[model samples]
Target chain A: MASALINVPAKAKRGDIIEIKTLMSHIMESGYRHKASGEAVPRDIITSFTCHFNGAEIFRADLFPAIAANPFFSFFTTATESGKFEFEWIGDKGFSETASASISVE
Target chain B: MRFLGAIATALLVVGAVGAAEIPLAERRSGYSFMKPDTKTMQDDDTANPGMLWVLNGETLWNRKTSAADKACADCHGNARASMKGVAARYPAFDKATGRPIDLEQRINSCRTNHQQATPLPFESRELLSLTAFVARQSQGAPIETGADPQLAPFVAKGRELYMQRQGQLNLGCANCHDDNWDKRLAGAAITQGHPTGYPLYRLEWQSLGSLQRRLRACITGIRAQAHDYGAPELVELELYLMSRARGMAMEAPAVRP
Candidate 1:
């Protein structure tokens, strides 16, 4: 039911600002709700996300349990002699997924 | 009485046009009822959560799940190439059962018969994924169900069910969808019920679900005992809906509020 979809511009002029969009499918349960049996649902969410540009950290987000499921994030960064943009998300239960996309900058 | 004469003629024209079915010129896709942002979300695969299932479906199609050691791709080939415009004619006649079966059932039938795999339970993630993927291939094709002669009786049965009042509220689908569509209901626009999209993404559910799922919700909303998933009655209703919306573009994996 949940999958990751990340988008990045394939090409951009040097020094141009490019938009990057990331979506992660997660329950993001806030742990505040009680079931019919009065048992608390455990909190599950991506606690942090970061993007590195050619090995340098460029964007970071700190998520909370209150975040909605399938959280989508969009941001912009200047396109410099692009090599690769790597993304990492860490969450509850040691959940981690990483993806890499490369862009050509002329 | 010139004004009275003109009003009588207009009412006569409407009555002659078959009041039960919306006129062709007024038939509109649910897309017209959506907010601009929701439409944008559906148009952009990157933002549409339903696409996630479609991507996984591609994986499942090639994974080869059964003891038969056959993948959907093995026989059907690339879904993009073989499945085009296929979903437009679902709730189709099945010779073996002599009953109509929706696309979901068709997929299961293929699995058990051709792939030697147990039928995926209705409402399972895999089923939703595969259906969305297949239906996506028919995105712009017109719905063409009820074309088979064998399906005519079922469509007739479906039409009866569609109009019959039921449940605690004694409200039938026709009461709202056919009679009062385009009007506001509980702050939401009541669209003329169209099933051109199936296995769609409903933000209320925050996931991709089948047409049957939506139907069950409506049934329950009327305080009715929601039919079991894969029930013939549900498929019948689906048939009736598809036939009603014939020639309309399909929009599977559609985003809905």
Candidate 2:
């Protein structure tokens, strides 16, 4: 697991368009290699990513092996209310991450 | 005649002193973490899966992909001739893009633009093989990069990044690979940082990985915020690493532990 950066607009007007960006560092092994002991390096990758606002799903995506080691994603949403935005990444090997940021609607 | 002889003797003495002050050639080989690691995995018996890509790359070099096109052989003639001394010059500063492009990027560009083929996805076998094939062309030529004006700033940034402390450990790349290269870390021998041989088959990785990938691993090992692939910061770091290996022979597709 590598570090990640999540950025969202500091503030947004009611019904205004808001943007969010995220980047994560991961080896994203394609299950194509072996271990130091000459055994196979099992394939492990972040299979899914999702974002929620105020406990409601806002965006989601599926990832493929072709994606680079460190993945970056950006998306836009309409702001209708103020609350918290939660981000999660699910991967093989039972790897999971959750990050959150507070949002305020003007 | 006496005055002329006296002047010649003085000049000879000065030249002798200057020569004496200069260190021996062996000491001028630049910085290196050349200490032998008893645990270093250097043989194929370790059996990294990445070696598969090199084999695949060899096939791709000879396999003709298009009707209008011939294999790499059609254009380059022979790997020994057309490819020789090429890898040593890469991660080159492309005047058109005004940025340093690594060998992987360059090979993809050539395939898309010239070979009339779709570019391979990053980290794919096709991309790895193509890169390995091209890199093998310059097996012995010394690395010679950073002469381009556009590359100077990138190299500078890379050097700065390499030395800057980061993460919870508060360690910089230089701390382990430079200052304490001869020391042990968690019972592992700290090797010198060198990019002369890359896309190397690492026993630890059990695969072949690019230098940038290795850089990302190092950052993660220290719990730092690693930059994404193709990120400006990573590119700059790559530039710095390559520059440090300037004049060293290219050893791409080299096997390592």
Candidate 3:
């Protein structure tokens, strides 16, 4: 039920290093904490996240239990041509989400 | 644990000054101590994790339940307009009950009486979501609780609870919030125990939680038995905190460390 938010410039210069920022709403429970009832909270975290530009891989990260909830990432990618930038996040319990933004290179 | 002595010593001085003459400048919202990044999260609607709960709440508000056969929107209309400044006055006196009730109880009563639906379970995700959603409407409004004559007795009770020491550690809320605020303990700053921002997203919890949830942690920290989520004691304390925090900007669904 978590929606992903991504920020990418609508237009960028060819060969420019464009900044991309993304944030996702997730608990990313590490399974180490105990509830009031003394039961351990189960682990549930985004295991992998990847970004592709024009159908080519650009950036990827393997998330771990140490990552904070509502994971946020900031990175730069070389703008090549006008196309869609696709992002995907895969996590425990078969959780997966994808979002895309269109980029136009000047 | 090592800082208990520092907290206690500070409280002794504040307690000796009596209640009336304390300068208003001492009152600071918990926001002041937040890391810059955390403050940014609270300020940015797009980045705050609490927005997730608020969005979920918006959906639930329009969805009809089996018992009511009507959605909240069916009667209340757009919450953005109807709920504006509503949260600021909460923990208000409920004339029907002849007692003060917090926002959570008010929401439950609406479910029971109007919607004919069972009250959402205390601290449940649905309850937190709805509460946050309603509270979001009051963002930037100033807190206006505790001024009613009928609410005076309850507020007094809450004040008494705030100052009374309890548990094995013999700690009262004032020990840290009123006296040692802005001071560090275990590398975390002590905030002034304000209730302006509730149903807040706490980084430590890694999720949105109600004020009662945070209060329980304080009680447990001092080795005291915690009250249940909807206990009257908690409600009274919430009322007192709100009154003490009057005029502070409401930041419901705030992000915290």
Candidate 4:
């Protein structure tokens, strides 16, 4: 969950626009290997990620095994009231992460 | 139980014998060019910060810490004599803890139990200096951590962890570093999972870091869950790495890209 914050200047004065940025870091395993006893290691990878702001759906993305580890993404959202932003990541083996940050509207 | 006891006894004897051996300079075979060059980044902009740490360690060796008012020199005398060959056997099995203990842990233990000083944080200059000082004595000596029966399981665990697939990408460490050592990812050449030279000054990190720190970086780089510093899993993995480089010499505070 290594992440950084960047302040973006808003071009649109009011409504909806997409904010796009990428995160770097996602272990995208193709799941191809032999175990200690010489058995094949199984496949697993992050499949999806989504973001919401102040309980409103804003953006979403799907990932594949080919995506490099520490998956990065860019997205957009309709400007409503500036508030809290939430991000979620869903992956194989039922792994999931949800992170949130606050945004202010001027 | 007898076999285990015998192995433990042998390990103790080896430790005792190692205490008497002269620490040699590390040998550089295939990767001689990786040695610190003038172009290598200086430590904290100081001239050869690693060397400075070693010098500070010498001072620390003689100066008594307030905790117990006992200096490393109090018991060991000249480090060139008493502490030789010690670093070459580290990442060794600690019978008391029942786990593989690296040189850093051993030093802290001595500081706490013997010298009565508070253990320095992982990357502190004091710890690093003392570590470099000790490792310098073993520069060219062959690493000789004897096999302990108790360490086998952990080594196996570490091996499994190394090859296991994890993270969003589901890539295991071995996939890139081992199997693909000769392969190119992005623009970098993937090197073998070697821990021969560690506590390295890295260009990417722009600072000195331990091998475990590097391991954590790799874990993060792969988008896998990185274990906490001093975690059992990381210790086990470190033991496995040390085993892989069984005969390699210790090259602490080395430079790396």
Q: Which candidate is the best by lDDT?
A: 3
Candidate 2's error at B56, in angstroms?
2.1
Error of 3 at B99 (Å): 1.5
Give the per-residue lDDT of model 2 (tens digit) for B1-257: 57645533443343333211112232122113333341222222122233345556767887777544757667777676887887787778876688888888887677766788777776676777778777767777888877677788888988889877787555677666555445454555566676776777665664567878889999987778888877778878888877776777776666555
Tens digits of per-residue lDDT, candidate 1, A1-106, equal 4468999999999999999998877767788988999999888788999999999999999999767777788999999896899999899987888888999999
True contacts kept of each: 0.42, 0.00, 0.42, 0.00
lDDT of 3 at B33: 84
Model 1 CAPRI rating: medium
**Candidate 2 Cα deviation (angstroms), residue B243:** 1.0
lDDT of 3 by residue, B160-214 (tens): 9888788876778877777667577667888888987898999888889998899
For model 2 the local lDDT of residue A30 reads 84
Q: First chain of model 1: TM-score?
A: 0.95
Score every model by TM-score: 0.92, 0.58, 0.89, 0.58
How high is the lDDT of residue B223 in model 1?
A: 67
Candidate 4, position B217, lDDT: 86
**DockQ of each two-chain model:** 0.53, 0.01, 0.53, 0.01
Q: In angstroms, how far off is A52's CA in candidate 1?
A: 1.3
Winner on DockQ between 1 and 4 is 1
Question: Chain B TM-score, candidate 4?
Answer: 0.79
The TM-score obtained for chain B by all candidates, in the order given, is 0.92, 0.77, 0.93, 0.79
